[model samples]
Target: MNILITGGSGFLGARLARTLLAQGSLALAGAPAQPIQRVVLVDRVAPPADLAADARVQPLLGDLGEQLAAGALPLADVQAVFHLAAAVSGECEADFDLGMRSNLDATRQLLEGCRRAGHAPVFVFSSSVAVFGDSPEQRLPEVIEDTTLPTPQNSYGIQKFIGEQLVADYTRKGFVQGRNVRLMTVSVRPGRPNGAASSFLSGMLREPLAGERARCPVAPETAVALSSPGNTVRGIIRASTASSTEWGARTAVNLPALTTTVGEMAQALERVAGKEATALIDWEPDAQIAKIITSWPSRFQPKRAQALGLAADESFEAILRDYVRENPQAVKLAVKG
Candidate 1:
């Protein structure tokens, strides 16, 4: 089997590629476990050295359009497609044109490409919690369930919701075997801040660990649903590998997540990294970021995802511990007797 991962150089994409390579085989619906012959990774930037050097990994270093046109996407042999590319929330809200191009148009093209391939490939789309939001009439419930309708409030949310619809319709038309997942705000991502309104969720811990100053855009009391990257990647893989009959009737699932407040996350950080590290965080707020983050529902009843075997983290402390383990050098050890 051959796999194609758009935005293959991203943190998740790269991690997924590494995982697939390590596993060596995939068991598809109603088919025997097939060896992965090739994994084509498409992104504007290059992947890490080890991943790029692997014989199975074929990196197409360019934009999606350019790579697709340049025969980088293995149309005929690609049995699975993980569409992880998109303009994130902050970027999408800031630039409408870029968001449409990256999120909507690119996804349609990928689906069409799969259709044209003459094989109904397993299409896994990475959607977001942004798909649900507050409108003028009523407020979104404290705990969002799968049955609740998506009422997007931002351009990014609208774009993601539309993408979900397209995937559903494409599946309905038998163009592709599609499954989309609404990801929560992935906390404790390792690196500098990006434009995402929820980036601070990670930064509140990530920056402080590295002895760098961090900013908290939202208040300490602000609570939001969060999932660790390990759990998220697990969910992604499961969504793509489930049997056709077991997959839900709908084309999307709201992934399970733990509800945690910013204060709790900070407290966890302090527990692990100490009071000095916690002091690195500044309590300055950004109205734009706060508004966007506040609009998102902090709790969920992702029944479908739970049934499908995807799980959320136990707590923010566990999440922080996982981060510390992954980056031991980033955190200072507690003094011993």
Candidate 2:
């Protein structure tokens, strides 16, 4: 089997690639596991050295939209596709054109490529919780259930929701076996922050533990829905591997979430790396960021995701500890003895 992962060099994309490489083969719909012959990673940047060194990894380095537009992506032979690349919330708000090109145009191109291939490959689209938002006309429920309608309040959210519809329509046409998974914010992400408004969720802990000061854009009481990287990868793979009967409806599956407030997260950081780490977080409110984050539903009843056998983090503290354990070098603060 040949696989394609867009945004293959990103944190989540790279992680998912490494996992697939480790497995060596994939079993789809109860069929025998098929050996992964090649994995084409499509991204503007290169992946980590270790992943690049893998014999199975074929790096397709460039802007995904450009490559797909130029007919450069070799999708004809691809048996599966994992679309994880997109302009994030902050970037979308800052530049609408870039968001349209990167998020909307690129997605349509990818689906078109799959349709032309005639293989009907298993396509997994990484959507976002941003798709659900509070609007003046329609207030969001306290707990977002599977049945709740998505009222995207921002460009990024609206774009993701549009992509979800595209995937669903493409699947209905038998162009691809599409599965859309609405991912919760992944907290405690390793490495430097990017354009995502939710980057602060990781930065608040990552920078602090790295012995540097960090900013908290939202108030302490602001709540969020989160998931760890491990849990997130699991959900992505399950979206593809699950049998057709088990996949249920074609609507997007809201990945499991661990809800917590900003204050509680700070407390968890204190418990993990002691008061020194917590002190490093500077609470500086930003109304723009607050409005965007607050609009997102912070609690969910992702019954579809649960039925797909996805699991959420036990607690925020556990998420923090997992980060500290997995990326020991990224943590400069000594764990309290």
TM-score, one value per model: 0.96, 0.98
Task: Write the residue-wise lDDT of candidate 1 on 100-153 in tens digits.
Answer: 988888888888888888878988999999988875687897789988888888
* RMSD, one per candidate, in order: 1.7, 0.9
Clashes of each: 0, 0
Clashing pairs in 1: none
Best by lDDT: 2
Candidate 2 lDDT, tens digit per residue, 143-253? 999889999999999999999999999999999999999999998899999999899999999999999999999999999999999999999999989777888788999
What is candidate 1's CA lDDT for residue 325?
82
Q: In angstroms, give how far residue 132 of model 1 lies from its true place.
A: 0.7
- Identify the candidate with maximal TM-score: 2
